[model samples]
Target: MAEKFSGKKFSGKTVYSGITMGKVLILRKDPQIRRVKIADPEAEKERVYGAVDRAKQQLAALYEKAVKEVGESSAAIFEVHQMMLEDDDYLDAICHMIQTEMINAEYAVSVTGDNFAGMFAGMEDEYMQARAADVRDISVRLVRNLSGQEEVDFSAMEPSVIVADDLSPSETVQMDKKRILAFVTVHGSTNSHTAILARMMNIPALIGVPMDLSEIRTGMTAIVDGAAGEVIFEPTEFQCSEAERKIKGEQEKLRLLQELKGKRNETRDGRTIQIYANIGSVSDVGYVLENDAGGIGLFRSEFLYLGRDDFPSEEEQFQAYKQVVQTMGQKKVIIRTLDIGADKQADYFDLGKEENPALGYRAIRICLKQPEIFRTQIRALLRAAAYGNLSVMYPMVISVEEVKQIYAFVEEVEQELKQAQIPYRIPEQGIMIETPAAVMISDELAELVDFFSIGTNDLTQYTLAIDRQNQKLEDFYDPHHKAILRMIRMVVENAHKCGKWAGICGELGADLELTREFLDLGVDELSVAPPMVLKVREKVRGI
Candidate 1:
């Protein structure tokens, strides 16, 4: 008879929320490499160069696949990988090692990758430290290509919980997503690309699990409780039954949410609100539609500017906007004009380093100073607006003069299009009420724009003088403070007095605890992450 084992449980940080039970699929670690002497160093250098080329091609393909699967923002990591491969310093280091050490290509790559990765790991900046994983990822790919080794064949495996020491962006993207029940890692960070992709994919994932790989075996049944951040191995019958019960409950909830599709987002008292979804790319429109969002309240257009060498041409921007506008089919699509700079830096922008970029030359500031870039995006938006329902909003606006300047630019673009005899329509214009100045003077700003969208994330940060990115201020970063609610009420009332509709497109929009309060505050709409649409709708109905 088989020996019985007691159930063991360990806690970790939850990357995504949900519960899943499946067999354990422990991923093997990378193969160890040993240095080997090469008779011809020059030949090995050529081989290394060839491997780099192949790696680039592989990354390009992965980029295309990821774009289709997860969307552009998440897929941009592969593009970054391609650029890293082309970096002269990185390539030169590998070549120099191969020639000077007279070693095989794989050994030189392994050593150089380790050295560079170690350097990045030692950096104080979290972003730079994250690049250590990228270095290791590309190195593994190159080593595999040189050795004629194949990638892990996830396609042939059955659906199970994916257990790994840590996963790189490439490895996470290349896995057969359909076969993955959940991801459990021994070591990972919430800021890691793998974590981001897992959340976007809507797969339950956990990181920092303190478990010994040797003690676990493949095919052992395991339970992943993402909400509790716990993983149970060889779960007892009672634990298994509880997991099954929770799974069934979740399935039932999903079924009921599906029924809410095509239903009105109206409260019990006949108060109606528009529930829209915020999206970063065209690929995310699928989720927006699947979740039955009334429309896209915030389409972050900056994704077009990121992950590229230079500005996206007018036609490129037009086609992207048009595709989204047309797909929504009469549903209002509010595209936020490039809100780049700050934490989101693009190399081609040549934006000099700033001491406080969040308050520096960004958003409307960059647009006003650089009219050529602004005109390009405005012209494209105008052309795309001709196809379907579309509107544009400017971020970081704090003055009437800025609004007037934006109007002048839009008029110039419209005149240019008119002279060229191009078909277009001037869509609705709005500004994000993110700054304290914007909110305080919202009454005046309301008259200049067609609508208002409250961006509570920034408003709360600026109002409280707390950097949202700082973990040290977590205790003080209270979004529910009376000050924030008062500001939202002020903006909504101001917009209403001017006969303009107001909505929220921030994290607070998805807070179920505040949904009733928002409705009572006379807010017209709430735009949140796609996954929260139904839950918010359900909450609105209950109230």
Candidate 2:
């Protein structure tokens, strides 16, 4: 007879969203390495180099596969892994140990890996610390290849939620992602590559679970509530049935929403609302269409600037913008120019250390200081405008004088484009009302732009004098403060008075409770995440 096990629940952080029920598949830990004396150091060194070559070839193949499985952006990590494998520091450490210590190739690579990983692990920055995993991953692959150890065959397993102490980016990519229903890591950060892969795979994932693995058994049924960051195990039949019911209900809701795709974005009162999606990259256009967004309210152009050694050229930017504009056809696409700096950093920008980056030079401030860079982006946007409906939006706009200066620069770019005989159009221009200064002078600022999009997230942070990044002050950070609502009302009213439409593209836009309030205040649109598009549309229909 099957032994009856007690039911247990574990709480953790959600890295992605979905509810899934499956059997447990515990990922085995890395095998232990035994140090052995080498009779031939020269031979060990040759073997180590050979392993590197093999690892490189394997990673290259994996990179191509990842590109097809996920997108190029997510797959780029494999390219980075290839570079890490060939890094002089890493190679030199392994070769030095093999030549000097007469150690086996596997032992030398293992020591070198630990040394390099420790260096990164000791870094003060969390992002840099997370990079240590990459070092360890490459080293392990090299060691495995040299030792002739077989890789884990996830394809042989039935569909299940993968439970692990941790998973490196490489491991996550190399695994048979198709068989994995979800992932639950006992040790991992929300910013880790595991989390990124989970998101790219569009599967539910939970991380930072405080669970004792000894208590977990393979083939044990488990329920993962990814949104709530909870995992239930060995639930009663009643509980399992209830969870299945909820899952079906959610699926039904989504099915109904899918039916509403391409439907008119009209409220119950017959008022039209421009429902749009905010995307961070060109690849997100697929989801935008899937959700039937009226248009793209914000296309964060910073992705091109980040994770690179140099600034993106005008041609590079143009091709990207053109692809998106052409794909969207006549649908409006508003590209928000380079909101880098602050939390989002680029080494090439040389945006020196700032005691208060959030309040200091960032976004438009950096762009304005570097006119050549700004002109490059403007030229790209203008050239792309020829293809389809594309509008440009400036972030962190604070004054009428700043608006005037921006116009002056735009005129220069227009003249340059004309002289070059470039075919383009003067698409609609707008500014993000995210600062208190902008909100206070919104009436004057309204007359300077074609429209207004209230960035309620930053406005609330700046107005409340609360640091949104600080978890300790989360309770005090109120997006619903009367001050924020009044500012939104002010921006919307001023926009109307100036013969312009007003929309919100912040987190507050997805707040269903605030939908009627915003509509009542004359807001014309709500731009939200792709997942919230249908929900917001449903709310709009209700109103």
Candidate 3:
């Protein structure tokens, strides 16, 4: 019989909601690197280059696999890894260390990886800090390839709850999804790629669990209650029974939600509203269709610019937009132009540091100043609009002047496309009402756009003057304040007065507590995360 111990419980942050009980599978920690003196520096340098080539190949395969499993937005991390492998600075540092110390390639890679990862970890930006894990992941792969070590194969393993210090994106993607009952980690961020992948896989995952590896043994019974953010070791028979009951409840709830798929999003009295899905990439289109979303309300185009150096080409942007619009067919696909800056930064932009980036240069400010970049995206968007129903929306607009400037760029792009004899159409244009300034002037702003999509996340942050990213302000941050509801009502009234449609494309849109209030306010649409589509629809039906 397997060794048994008294039940112990630990808490963590929930990344996904579900319940499962299984044996514990402790993931092997990082490999130890032994620094060996090499006989020839040149030979070692050649060996390092060879291993990099092999790692690049492996990453390329991983990218394709991830794209198939998770979608392009989540899989883009692998592409970033491939770029990191090719980075001249990273490769040069590894080569310099090997030549200077006459050390083996594996040792050089391990040290350089730590140094680079440390630099990222020390950054003030959370997104940059997350890149530290990426650095470590790529480094580990190179080391394994150099040492002829094989990756852990979970394909043959029995279903179990995986316990790890932290899982990298690559490791999570490589595992067999069917074998993963749940994931419990000692350390990880909800914003990390691994967490994102877990959600996409629809697996129960708990992060930041405080547990000692020595206390966990393979085959030991474990229960992961992701909804409660708790992990129970050597769970008692009663605990297992309760977990099984919760699992069945979840399954029954899902079955009921699935029944609402083909049903219309209409209230009991016949008040119908468009229920759409917010997507980050092309891969999310499948989910949108699966959830029976009437259309895609927000297709965040920034994913194309992220995870890469330099700007995405006009052709690249065109193909991406085209794929989405065509795939969605006649269904409305509203694509927001690049809303880079703020927390989402690309090094190539050289945006520089700021004391208050959230209030400074970003979104429409960057696009207006950098017309060339704006033109490239507009040109692609217009060309893609020819294929199907597609509309464009600008983010961070606070004035009539900004909207006017955007139209001028749109006209210029339209003319260029016409001159080149490219098949294109000027799609319906709109602006995001995210700022207090926009809300106040929405009456005037509504006349200039075809529609309005309220980005409640930023609107709430700006209206409340609270940093949404700050944990310390969590106590005071209230999205349902009377002021916000008044603002939404005001914006909706303004849009309707101008014969324009308005929709909520923020986190609040999915808040079931306020669903009836939003409907009463005459909000025309609610675009939420894909999984929330059916639930929101169910709420609407009950209302």
Candidate 4:
């Protein structure tokens, strides 16, 4: 009977949304690695190096395939994998172990992988913890190659929802996307690479699921609701039909929203508003265009700073900004300067622990203190401005004086570019009204900047005096509170009074319930995630 289990349900975080009804396909947690004695140590070393080359080639193939399937931005992770293989830290550890311990190549690689993976897994950051999977993935590949064993083949199975401890980018790319209905993992976060791939595939996925794998078996019927982050084992026929109906209903709703593409974003009362996307990487440009976003309202440049050992070079930063600007074409791209500190930390930045990182030594404060770093970013943004419709926005601005200081640095960068005879345009500059202080002095700050983008996430966090990251305080982190609405209205009025425009690029911007309220407040733009763009656009058209 395949150990039929029904009515068993578990909850998790939804990384992507959809309804999936399919048989369970549970993958083995990890391939069993065996240790064997080798005749020659030198031969073992060569074997390890050979495995590295083969792995590199495999990742390169996956990279090209991913770029074609997804976008260049999303496929960039494979490039990271190739780098991981080439990373001296990882490679050296394996080589050192083989030479010093006189162990076989496969054993040395496995040991080193465990050490490195453990170090990363022990890190407090979720992103770093995910990197541990990469180490294990490469190690498995090397071992499999050394042993002349073929990787697991799931091609023969019928289409089903994949259940696993976790999945890597390499594994994800190799899967038959058409055969896999969705992904349910026992471990991973919404930001994990597996979750990101699910979103890219536009399929339902539930990560960090709490379930007993022993109770799950192949051929058992299952229902995965990504939005609710719930999985039902051995669902009844009626339950499956109901889920299928809901899935079709949601798909139809999305289709209707897609019909609104190319249509002007206008309210029922003849009011026009701009709908844009808040993107973090160049790959996100595809989503922006797909949703017919008016522009890239907030390009979170912090992504360029993370996942590396040191600060990104000026040219590296420039190329990234230029790629985004050129792709957006006539549509404006508002690039927010590196907003680090708080939760977004870099070891290179050496931002020491603070009692309150959110309020201390972050964003504009860090930039103002490190003008050289700020200048490097500004120079890149300024130079890229000549290439496309690019603008600049600063985060965590609290006072008019801080805005003035930013402008002063902008002038310095502009003069240096002029001295070099570099072709650049003075991009339209603005600041994020995230702090309560910024709202109180919006009237003064509004006169200085070209526009205002209310970052409601931080605004609500600071207003409610709650740490949004803390689960205990989640109930207190109300985004639709009256105080936040009032602050947004005040900023909009201040911007309008100064003949400037105000837009929102935060979680609240995607709230359909607040769409009419924002329009009523005279907010000029709503920038949200790419998937929410059409939905927000539909809301605007209906209002």
Candidate 5:
């Protein structure tokens, strides 16, 4: 059933209210890309196992030209593409092909039992869509390398919005931020790197525009109102006026937020609440400092592992960690090391496909099994401590035994650091009180760590046994459910009784209505998305 909506415009603006037959923004993309078959299915064709290496050399040349012509950061964007070409598992199959030397791209790719590479490229999911660019970027670079083509000068390219099927992290980051007005991808999510980078750059962007967005001409005007999740294609007279008014309103709200920015988050009666930023990368470190956040309440170190094709080196990890610490200066930055789980981890380490991944291999369970991987991450974090106040946090700590084991490992690394005379910093360590077992051990767990940060998103999922992402149980996953609030109160009050602080770095932290309840429950700190910082601060201050 096609239901159309009609409503009067809000008092201050004009609107095109009648239902017109056109594409609408509802998370689905416009003119979905037709799946492409990369390799031939049946033939005596051969594979080039060393094709990725050829791709790497090509990317290096392109990057060299990019670095000299553009800024260093623009060139640095190619690292992931370079890393993709180096994926051992991905390249291993290519190397082990059994056939003649020459083959078509399809023949080369057809050796695999499953078309994971093609499927990965075809996915609508942001992270997975990013892989598409990775595969293609490497492929294109290899083609150029093999052809001995001269690199194009990036300096002369004019800034223009890219209208394409989709973009990978590498592809999105490579474009000139100054030149690109906005990205009109036929497919993507609000959380996609394309959307995220747009927000970061303050560029007006609309994702998932319906009906062949690529066909939208080069100079056609578009109003990418991401907040409203809509795009106005060559807006009408009424739309022009309407958009101007909405922009004014949004800008006024932002102005009001700026007025409240940097102001202490305290109640009129003198109750103080610590406001912090929830972050995953060094790029976010600057947001915390600029916004006067009390500290980085939840610094997810997963970026070191998440979204990467390979594990980052200890020194490489340290450089990223040290950047955050140095940028933070004296304030504390709590770093949560590698929170990969079977259910949430979209990585190469196949843990035997299971029916229910949520209840299976995840968090501490996966980390404990991969001791070498865990130790390397811990060692990198410890080394990063030499720069400033850096605290190590463990995620998905489910039981007393798990906490004891990981804490013991931490001690082992500390002792090893001392013996090696490695200069490093080790701030107070803590646990993410997400799992029910960990929450049950609040008193005993608090004794083991410096503080507690409640991951309400996971806690809600585990406690209610409702996967928020499932959409089916979204109704049952309400944060306001009595059971969830009770559990939150139980965890918060328990932490306080144990003389420890409990902070919220979950989606609940930013919900305006729930903010009061969270405050009432005595949450010591609130870490939120960057956009909500000033609003939450203002709301908390008035309370």
Candidate 6:
């Protein structure tokens, strides 16, 4: 039975109802600044620069107005765009176009956006594609406002589920998370922060939904299940009752799983298994430490970079890493070095261009190219190592030579630190075995790296020759594909043969069907989504 109260929270079971949005994605674009030379070069120069300056100031003013309405801390994230507009390079890039290049302001913004659009189009990573969208969004807003178009309203629209091509940082914060049920976007992948935000808020999100927002009417009922990628619109009573029952059963299962936390996860055959949450922030470490997790399976460093506009300093990264290591006390923390691909790492730092970016430069590949960034992370890992057991893992390893090259650099840094008489710990080194080539040579890779963690997301995609981002094949990209399971089994068996532990750290590890398969294949550990932890543990314990 259901009863309506002023406040919402039902204890009997979790009933996820109401209108949930799908396909929510962020848009980022910066309008072009025009530079025109009408015979009088100096006169034209002053005019163009003035327009650029005025446009910058206008964005700042709009943001200031926005902040006064929203709280200070709540608005800080949006204000970064204003700051970016004021950057000396950004300003000069526009101002110089008018004086030296003789480009019009509108055309300049248009040219910049066009160039970026073309560049992003050639790239393979989905994260870069979304950022390219952001570039276009921010550019349009700037150009429209500078052209004296009606000032766009910054007011908060009703907290309806946002159905968009994508969501931007500004668009996401403008949305009240409590009221926004879900995001349905014509475009998006798991990489976008909009989808991540939806996941964090426990809201259902479906990306690459086959419909457009114009089809949706306000208050029209809908169903959104992120796991199933299912969205039902204008459901019948039978469907509603079925949805309710599914949610209720899931909740009851969750309740039972919660009861099992702090209980050791062991098979009925008396084999003990370690299950841990893959955390990023220090607080996540704290949150999971209270549970029955064996430890933090994966501490992703990208969160530190993505959380800010500028690159985090070595000391800053060190401290954050230290917090997680120290807090977990004796629990193990397997820290993965900067997993952000150049395509994925969308901060102020631009590494350079690439071709077939998915297979090009990313993770350890990019880190190796940018040793300064890689070394600082290694240094931080060494320093944080003093706090507890720290396992260092490199992402996107495909070749044995690349692994050796990374090891050489790591050893060089350790030697330099030794020569400098610095005291720090060097944790066990490992590599994320994700690529098809790596899985094929798992036995050899196991002989090299300290341990191996299967990043099944990329592995499956690479093996199947299917782009998960392409909605056309979304229906065909299955983790349980026979080929994928065979690859997983090969890696696990190789790790055991070489006296190295193999763990699954990707989404497939959290999936129900694959969990049993991994157990049967003899996985040493599994790091899954937080909510999936207890359930996975319960499943393992019962067996």
Number of the top-ranking candidate, with TM-score as the measure = 2
The 10 consecutive residues of candidate 5 with the worst lDDT sum are: 12-21
Model 2, position 279, has a per-residue lDDT of 80
Flag regions of model 6 displaced more than 4 Å: 1-80, 83-160, 173-180, 215-221, 232-242, 280-283, 286-291, 307-309, 342-353, 418-423, 474-478
lDDT of 2 at 421: 100
* Poorest stretch of ten by lDDT in candidate 6: 5-14
Q: What would the per-residue lDDT of candidate 2 be over residues 38-129, giving only the tens digit for each residue?
A: 88888888898899898888888888987775446557777999999878888888888888887788888888888888999998765677
lDDT of 3 by residue, 1-543 (tens): 233564788998888877888889887667679999988999999988998998888888888887776556557778989999999999999999988899999999999999999999999876687789789989998998888875554667898899999885557667876788888998877656566556545678998788887777888889899889899999888888898899889899989999998999999999989998888777778888988898999998986786554678898889889999999999999999998888777766778889999898998899999888898999999999999999999999999998998998899888888999999999989888999999999999999999999999889989999986575898998889999999999999999999999999988998999999999999999988788899999999999
Worst lDDT window (10 residues) for model 4? 191-200
> lDDT tens digits, residues 344-382, model 5?
454444455668777877776777999888888888888
lDDT of candidate 1 at residue 103, scale 0 to 100? 87
Point out the higher-scoring one by TM-score: 2 or 6.
Answer: 2
Candidate lDDT scores, in order, read 0.86, 0.83, 0.87, 0.84, 0.64, 0.68
Tell me which of candidates 4 and 6 scores higher on TM-score: 4
Model 5 clash pairs are 38-106, 39-106, 40-106, 49-94, 49-95, 159-179, 385-425
Tens-digit per-residue lDDT, 1-543, candidate 6: 012211111111111222243222222223235555445446644654555566566557655754654334334545655554555655565556555676556655556656656677668765455456545654565566546652333254445555566665556645445567667666665777775565444466666666545445445555565556566655656766776777777677657777887788788888866797777556455457545678878877886677444666778778878878787788888999998863476545565567676776678877888899888888878877878888899999989999899989988888977888877887989999889999998889899988999998888878888877665786777768999888888998999998999899987887777667788889888987565677788888877
Worst 10 residues of 2 by lDDT: 1-10
lDDT tens digits, residues 256-310, model 4? 9889889998978899999888887677688788878899999989877864446
lDDT for each residue of candidate 1 in 1-543, tens digit (9 for 90 to 100): 013444889898887778999998887566567789888988898888888888888888888888776556567778888888888888899999888888888888888889889999998765677679788888988898788764555658899899989875546657776788889999977645566556556678899899887778888889999889999989999999999999999889889988998899999999999999988777778889989899999998887786555688898789899999999999999999999988777666878779998889999999999999999999999999999999999999999999999999899999999999999999999999999999999999999999999998788888999986575787887779999999999999999999999999988898899999999999999998787899899999998
Residue 414, candidate 6: alpha-carbon lDDT = 86
- TM-score of model 1 vs. true structure: 0.81
**lDDT, residue 125, candidate 2:** 69
After superposition, candidate 2 runs with Cα above 4 Å error: 1-8, 13-17, 23-47, 63-93, 104-107, 113-137, 140-222, 233-239
Clash tally, candidates in order: 0, 0, 0, 1, 7, 37
Q: Which 10-residue window of candidate 1 scores lowest in summed lDDT? A: 191-200
